[model samples]
Target: MGKQVVAESARRRRRPTKQGTVLTEAHIVETALRVLREHGSAGLTARRLGAALGADPSTLYRYFAGMDELTLAIGEELIGRALSGWLPGGDWREGLRELGLRIHGAYLAHPQAAVLTASRVSGRPREIEADEAILGVLRTAGFPDRAAVRIYHAFIDQTLAFAALDAASLALGRRARESDEERWESTYAKLPADSHPHIAATAGLLSARMKDSAYPAALDMLLHSAATQLAAARAADRGASGTSAR
Candidate 1:
C-alpha cells in the first residue's frame, strides 16, 4: 500500500507521451472519465484509453499499475467532483442532505462510470476526505462518537448503494430502458383492480411517478430515522445523568 501510494504520487508529477502530449496522472484520469462517459463502462480498456490520450497502451502502465488502479483513480475523481467547493454550514442535517444530493448528481451525471465504481472502495485521497467530512458533520451535530461513526457508515453506504442502483438503471441499453418504462406504463398500469387492488388503484400515480428516481425519498427517510435515533440517545443520556445526580 505504501509503495502504491508513493507511485501514485510520483505519477501525478509529470510525464511526456510519445505523441508529445504531456501526460500527468490528472490528464489520464480526466481522459478516462471522458472515455467512460462517451463509450460506456466496457469501452474503458487500456487500448481505448491509450488511443484517447494519443499514446501507447503501455504508457498507461507507468502511471497506473493496471486498469483496476486506473478505475480507482477515476472513481476518486468522481468523488472529488462531488465534494468540490462544498463547505458545511453548521446545520448538520442540511449540510449532509446537500452533500448527498451533490454526490448523487455527480454519479448520475456519469451514469456509466457510476455503475462501474460507485460501490467500490477506492481508499484514495478524495474518498478519505469525503468520509472525514461526513463524520465531522455528524459529530458537529452533537452525536456521540459511536453514534456519529455508525450514522456516517450508514449514510455513505446508503448514498453509494442508491447511486449504483440508479446508475445501472440509467446505463441500461436504450431498448432495455424503454422496455422497462413501457412495462411500467402498459403492464403495471393495466393491472386488474380486482386481482391487485392496491397497485391497480394507484396505477395512474405509479405510472406518473415511475419516470423519476426514488432516491430523494429514500434519502430523506434515512436521514429522518438517523435524526430520531440521535435525539433518543441524547434524551437517554440526559435522563441517566439526572438519575445519577439524584
Candidate 2:
C-alpha cells in the first residue's frame, strides 16, 4: 500500500501542471495527428502523447472524454486539412475532382491515422464543412437538393474507400508491388479456355488494365455517369415541380 501511494504521487507529478490553463482543442487534436503520423496507430497511447507534451496522460482527459473522442478530433482535423484553401467557383467536375485529390493526398500524408479513422464518419464540425462544401458545389451546378445529396454521398464514399485502399497498397513498398504484379501475370498466363474463356483470350489486356493503368479511366467514367444521372434527376424534379405549381 505504501509503494502504491508512492507510484501514484510520481504519476501526479508527471501530469500537466496547469489545471486551469486554456488548452485549445485544436492543439490537442494536432498533437494527436503528429503522434499518428510519426508512430502509427499502435503508438498513440494517451501516456505517450502526454509525455511528448510534458504533461500527464490525465491532461488529455481534460480535452477528450476518452480515446474515442480523441479519434473523432483527429478525423475532423484530417478532413479540415484537405479542405483548406478550397473554394467553390469552377466547373463542378473540376471542383469535385480537386476535392477528391486533396482528400487522397491528406490521407496518404498520415496513413496511420487514415487507416484508423477512414472507416467511421465523425460528423464533427470539420466533417460537416467538407460535406457542405461538396453539396454546395453540386447544387450550384444545377442539381436539386436530393440529387446533390446523392452525388455527394457517392463522391465522398468513393474517395475515402479509394484513399484507404491506395494507402494500404503503398505500404507494400516497391518490391511488393512488382512481385504482386509478376505473380498476377503468371496466373493470368495459365488461364485455360475451359476455365475463363474470355479472360484467357484478352488475358494480356485484362492483366494490364486490372492494375494501375485502368483506375484513372474507370474513375473518370464513374464520375461522368454520376454527373449525368444527377443532372437528369435535377431536371426531372424541376419539370415535375413546375407542372404541379401550374
Candidate 3:
C-alpha cells in the first residue's frame, strides 16, 4: 500500500509521459473540453482522454485526482472565459449586465460541459475571482456589505441557474430540440381561446419569445431591482445625514 502511494505520487510529479507527450494541467483540461464537445460528459472517461492525448490512461491521474476533479477544472475554464478581457466600467449596472451575459454565453458555447459543471462549486481560482469582482462592483457602487452580498448571491445564482437551464435545451439532439421548439407553435399556438384565454391571447408572442433563452430579460429585471434598492438606500442615508446635522 505504501509503495503504491509513492508510485502514484512519482507519476504525478512527472510531466512527460512514456508516449513522449508533455502534459500540463491546462493541456489536459483543454483535451477534456474537446472530448466533452465531441462525445459529451458521459464520454469523457480516462481512457478516452488518454487516447485523445496520445498518453496512457494512468497519465491523467498525474494532473487530476479523478474525473470529478477534472470536471471542476472544466467549470473553472468556463468562468475564466467569461472573465477574460472583461473590464468593469463606471456604470455598475452595465458592467454587471455584461458580466452576466458573458457568463451565460460562455456556458452556452459549451453546452455539453456546462450541463455537468454549471451547478458545481469549483472553489477554484476563476470562480473565486469572479465572486470578488462582482462584490467589488456592488461595493464600489455605494452598496453596503449586506446589500452587496445579497445582490451578489442572487446575481451569480440566477446567472448559473439560467445557464444550466438553457444549456440543457441546447444539449438536446437537433431533432429533439427542434421538436420541442415546434411545440410552442404547433400546440400552444393552436390552443382554443375559450379554454386557455391568456395563453391563446399571447400565443404569437410566446411562439417568438419562448424559443429564446430568457436570461437577458431576467438579468435586466434583476439589475433594475438592484438599482431601485440602491436609490432607496442612498435616500435613506441622506435623510439620516440631514437629521444628524439638525
For every model shown, what is its TM-score relative to the native structure? 0.91, 0.74, 0.93
Q: Which structure among the candidates has the greatest TM-score?
A: 3
Pairs that clash in candidate 1: none
All candidates' lDDT scores?
Answer: 0.87, 0.76, 0.91
Model 2 residue 183 CA deviation (Å) reads 2.6
State the lDDT of candidate 3 residue by residue for 25-136, as single tens digits. Answer: 7888888989998998899999999999888888677667778888999999999999999998789999999999999999999999999999999899999999999999
What is the per-residue lDDT of model 2 for residues 1-246, given as tens digits with 9 covering 90 to 100? 111212323333333344433345676677788887677788899988886665678766656668887898888888989999988787888888888888877887877788878878888988999998888898888877887787788888878887777766665566987877786589886789798998788888877766663334545776798778876877888999999999
Worst lDDT run of 10 residues, candidate 3, spans 1-10
Q: Where is model 1 more than 4 Å wrong at Cα?
A: 1-20
Decide which is better by lDDT, 2 or 3.
3
TM-score of 2: 0.74
The CA-based lDDT of model 2 is what? 0.76
Local lDDT at 215 for model 1: 81
